[model samples]
Target chain A: MTASTAGTRLAIDASDLVKTYKGGVQAVRGVNLRIPAGTVFGLLGPNGAGKSTLVRMLTTLSAPTGGSASVAGFDIVRQQKQVRRAIGCVAQNSGVDVQATGRENLLLQGRVYGMRGVELNRRADELLLRFGLAEVGNRFVKTYSGGMKRKLDVALGLMHSPQVLFLDEPTTGLDPEARSEMWEQIRELAWDQGLTILLTTHYLEEADQLARNLAIVDQGRIVVEGTPDELKAQLNGDAVSLELAAGSDADTAKSIALEQGGVLSEIGVDGLTLRGRSADGAGAVPALLAALEAADIHVASVTVARPSLDDVYMRYTGRSFNAAEQAAAHAAKEEKK
Target chain B: MSALADTWYMTGRAFRAFLRQPMYVAFTLIQPMIWLLLFGQLFKSVTQLPGFGASNYETYLVPSIVVMSGFFGAGWGGMAILDDLTRGVLDRFLVSPVNRASLILGRLIVQVLSIVIQAIIILLFGAAVGASYHHLVMGVLVLMVATNLLATAIGALSYGLALLVRREESIIAASNFVLMPLQFMSTGFMALVLMPHWMQDITKFNPVNWTLVAGRGALGADPDWGPIFENLGYLAVLMVLCAWVSTRAFRSYQRSM
Candidate 1:
């Protein structure tokens, strides 16, 4: 597998990619993305947002039902093996053999890629050292800590030095310390090696911290795509949050909040809590309070904060990210019953 | 790497993993020894009956026990595939350039090796009990070859079910359903002539009987070369059929993915 030359050429170019599984579940719908070489891109979404389905299709693990995608200039459908060779995938689930030692796991992965002899051994050793797994390299992976197992998963994917790496929900289950360590490692991989990394995550903070560019996927579609700062900056103001008193109709409060001039977007409500965007949050507070009181809505508290990825998601998807997540969970629970 | 080279590498890895589980190997060997001693003592008078194949019941029982061990051991080979599947190790192999057939074949090779070892242990135990392989060296070699082919064929079927079922409880349940009935229906523990006329007719088509008849023909003072070669032919065909079924199962598994 040859690496692409340094240029503005796209490392990953996917257009209107769609995946409809058996039983008519459409996991990915009309996803379009263009990621340039040597960038850390994140596909940010809550659970069941189809982030993994898109990653699976790109990695050649699952086939898409419609549209097309190309990874490292190889067609995902016509040149599947080429795509598989060009890109490394660290799936959501850990893929390391639990009974095998960390070193043996790396060697097995390298051999599967057709690497053998002294060169394969040297590369395996180098990765163990790089991922801080050299100390326990001989121990079976079942005995490794969760963080160490995750590190080895990443190390396995990097054994062949592919041009592009796909890390699906890389930090979903890691503790804070391990998450930061993984973030540092990802930063180094992109900065030092110039590796193009496509990372998927549900953690908005993870995307904000580690990704140079990101797309917010919700319910099988990309709601918005840009750098984290740019996406948040598009809101152009502070987020005004208020806790309405009990028995207050959130819809009525929203209507009152919208009537106040300078309200930039819809008022997001989760039960008695309401939020909206405004250019001058402090200046509009008194008018908003008066309007709410006049409408018989009692305001318990109010706070103004800088826009975050959450607010950006709220702006595009028309629902608070947290609420969408809760609703999805509740739906899943109901289905289980 | 070529498919053969890949198969060899995977076979080595699988064999090492199997060796690490010393308890599993110990139990696998211990079970057959118990069966040989306990069952041999219990049925020692069966040779006195007419139409019995041999005077020494120990010699008559040795070959059947070896074939039974091979069959029983191979019936659980699917558990290995299930472990690989649930752990995502199989997916790692699937996404790579490794040969698909080699993955299934490598696990079968481990089963074949285990079957040979089990057969040797039984043979040594029979020797200690005054049961001799009059053909001696050639008898042991032929028995190993027969057990190896039988184990691999059954192993292929076991792994095929693993890929299809993809559940441990289901595989264990399915194994229990097939193994004992298969053994009793064949001439595994009794002479075909001693069985009912109907059982004798049906046992001729049973794969386990083919293995047992071939294995017993190679043992004792008068070695029957004709039936041994003929039964070996039947086992060779069964081996190819099982391998093809496993290959098709792998394809269905990929499509499901």
Candidate 2:
């Protein structure tokens, strides 16, 4: 929580930020952050893990039930207006007006920040063009593809050119191409304009690819925080993942590998899959594969790779990443309905 | 920009969105006119009954119909707010430097505009039927102002309810629950004299009845300015009070989040 970030000018600084909602639901539990200016920081988590809640507090959309936070050096509680003016927020949910044209949404957003007439129109046109939405600027947003709508959401956030941009789950529902495009825009915003971006995403690749530093949030708390490379490097060895064909006995593979495959160690078998870490992945692969095949295990696919964010998540949370995600997805489904 | 300027801009957004959704606007405007026309025609002969206020049912119902149109139109104000809430448009504005008052005022203006449009059409339909306006400009002017004030109150209350409920179905159910009974209890359909004694007592406390009394007073050839101003004054105060409550409801919404 006290780790010093890289720069003197911290864009967002919070100490022990806590937001406990009604009925004893602690949505955010004492999270601290120091995000330097001109960089991207990611809050990576599954659904219902309080990433959005934390972002909401930082954006001044919801007051912290307990702790304090300041955005752009203005206290969020005492100086909400300044905090609001200093930050541009794009929530997990798309905020574009479906009935209005893309250009219209941007212009209104500009006026919301007190920008007027010529300046507002110029900013709107610039955002539309920069986001590749210039051609369809006049069309209703409802008709736009999911990716296009998402780009407009990001464009709308940048309309007023605030000091920091907060993006919550920016790539959640976007198609692959659109997600890549949004990534490009985000990268450009940080590198080109020297804008500070606080992005929240569940996608591991999103954090690894874009974030200068990231934190994994689960059950209303930050489990781990560091650069993606640093977090993955915390573990000492390469990650080994293998899936078995249907009806193959995972126990037979695990016992056979431990007994015969001397090179492979610390192996874990879960249902039809075996996951473990290896000191020497290249050296262990041949022995592990031979032992599993000799034991009549139908090895579906074997992968030896670098440690990923998901592995870091598993190491810290003691639960499979996808399992947490499936549960969060279910809760989110029930919530919206 | 000032909150007032922001409100103006926000109002433009709401107004444009209302116009853009042609189908929804068409239906909202049309439903009340059908009620006015049918109520006028179906109950044309009811005016002959004892203690009926006017020579024809249409003329007597015209002023009440104007209030009814405004009330009904204002009820849908919640739906508009709910659309923005569920769609995250409200959150976008909340997280920005946008004024909290502007968020409420902007939509209130749009809701009043929507109700007033319907009020004008209902008035014209009334004139087309048996209803007559000797001082057309004066009569329409009073009703327009009255409609704006009353609709503002109704719209504010609708927005408060929408914030409290946060569900579209609840808004619809709550609007119907509060509105249907209130409309029937007011002097919208029948003369107060024709109603049961108990119902008449309730009508005195009804905001809709207060509006009806004001509208009908202004509609007369020899209009009574004092009583009309009195009711309009009450409605203006109610508008202020309701707007305050609705604005405070934003706190409740944020608390829920």
Candidate 3:
């Protein structure tokens, strides 16, 4: 990480970044990230994983409790304004002022960056058109739909042509359609425009689909870091899912499947579904099916998958992502009281 | 240059939001008139007393109303900052290359502008009710500046309170607690000479009364620029002090984040 070089490849270079809130809640313990320029790096985690806290420190919204980090090679603490100038941050919470028109927000954001007159207007217009906000650009943001308001938030962040972009759960509250639309926009942003983007998302599908490289964050630390495919490949085998008949006993089905297994890792069973792992999945299925059939266990269907991000999470964290999220959510509620 | 530009742009953002609620503007201008018209008439004979200085009470009440209007109006300034803080807009601006001063200045600009406009209206309403000043227009001008200085000071303090507490009920309760006593303690509602000796001593230190004295002093036939400027200087000092306290609150905000 060359602080003086104008052409440093690491758009974001962080080391041992930590954030402990005043009440001693160590939201972010010790996390390090080095994302190359023009790559979409993702931080995937559940609630209370300190994803938001880390983003806050990196974006210069919060002071780090310890350690150091830099964006665009400028120290986050010392060169905050430079880091702020080099990066555009779209926080988990939408920062749009609902009272102001979409265009008005853009103009103000552009002006804050020292843009003026016609050039500013042209950039604002271009972003409005690009984000499909041109139709509702003159309307107050309160009137805009969730997707439109979110698009405007991105537009506000992009007004100054920042070198790096931080999108923290950018599609968190959008409906499926809007979420996919945002995905396409993010894809375009990464593929065509080539900006270094650091996105934090709890949605496995979101991280899998968009991020070129990602880190799995849990309990304030990076559990694993690699490309999505690399993480799933670490699972190394087939994820066999058995949809048992509606009336079939889940407990009985689990034991029957476990009986005829080699190199099988028991993944959990939910209601009428039983899932497990096998290195020789295609070959092992028939015998396993015959054994269940002999026991009068009626099988509805069986399918095999090449490990998902969830499976990778389960393997590393020793718990499913949803369970971790639920436990964290419960703890958060207790802490709030 | 960019820092000043950012502050100007921030003011524009707050002003746009201020305009969204026409009801706010209505209440801001009209509420003070209720005090001017009704309270001025109710105490119509107060000017007959020695040391009241004016020919009638309404004329005396006009400058006081201008002072009170800005005082109360500026007290709610924290609510807007709290709204922005909760809405994530404050973090948006904070993470940008925006001058930190812009956040305070942005809201202050709107507060001052609102008080200035409303102060002019209050002065005119006083005139309509037979409250004539010796130098009518110039007097109103001085009152506007004085009132705005007071408003900016209060607005900065409100913003500081918001950043510190980050709670609505706390800001509202704090505003009421601070404003109610300060409102009556000053010469805003009573002639200074008629006030209790102890209360008059408090008035000497009260920024609100300083604003009143400055505005009222300018309206007299023989305007004393010396005392008026002195009061303005007091208001300026108060503004700077409040601004310092408010900016210090930002450090707390940053650390808490």
Q: Candidate 3 local accuracy as lDDT?
A: 0.88
Residue by residue across B38-157, what tens digits does model 2's lDDT show? 887788887788897678777788788778777877887888888999899999998987778888888878877777778888877777876777567777788778877877888888
- Best by the TM-score measure: 3
lDDT tens per residue, model 1, A191-253:
999999999998889999989999999989998999998998898788888999889899888
Candidate 2 off by > 4 Å: A1-8, A240-276, A283-303, A332-337, B135-138
Docking class of 2: medium
lDDT of every predicted structure (CA atoms) = 0.86, 0.85, 0.88
Task: Please give the lDDT score at residue B47 for candidate 2.
Answer: 79
Q: What's the lDDT of the predicted structure labeled candidate 1? A: 0.86
lDDT of 1 at A33: 95
Model 1 chain A, poorest ten-residue lDDT window? A1-10
Model 3 regions more than 4 Å off:
A1-5, A241-275, A290-303, B48-54, B222-227
Instruction: Please provide, for model 3 over B123-168, each residue's C-alpha lDDT reduced to its tens digit, 9 standing for 90 to 100.
Output: 7888898887888788778888888888888988998899999999
The best candidate by lDDT is: 3
The estimated TM-scores of all candidates read 0.90, 0.90, 0.91
Give the winner by DockQ. Answer: 3
User: In candidate 2 chain A, where is summed lDDT lowest over 10 consecutive residues?
Assistant: A1-10
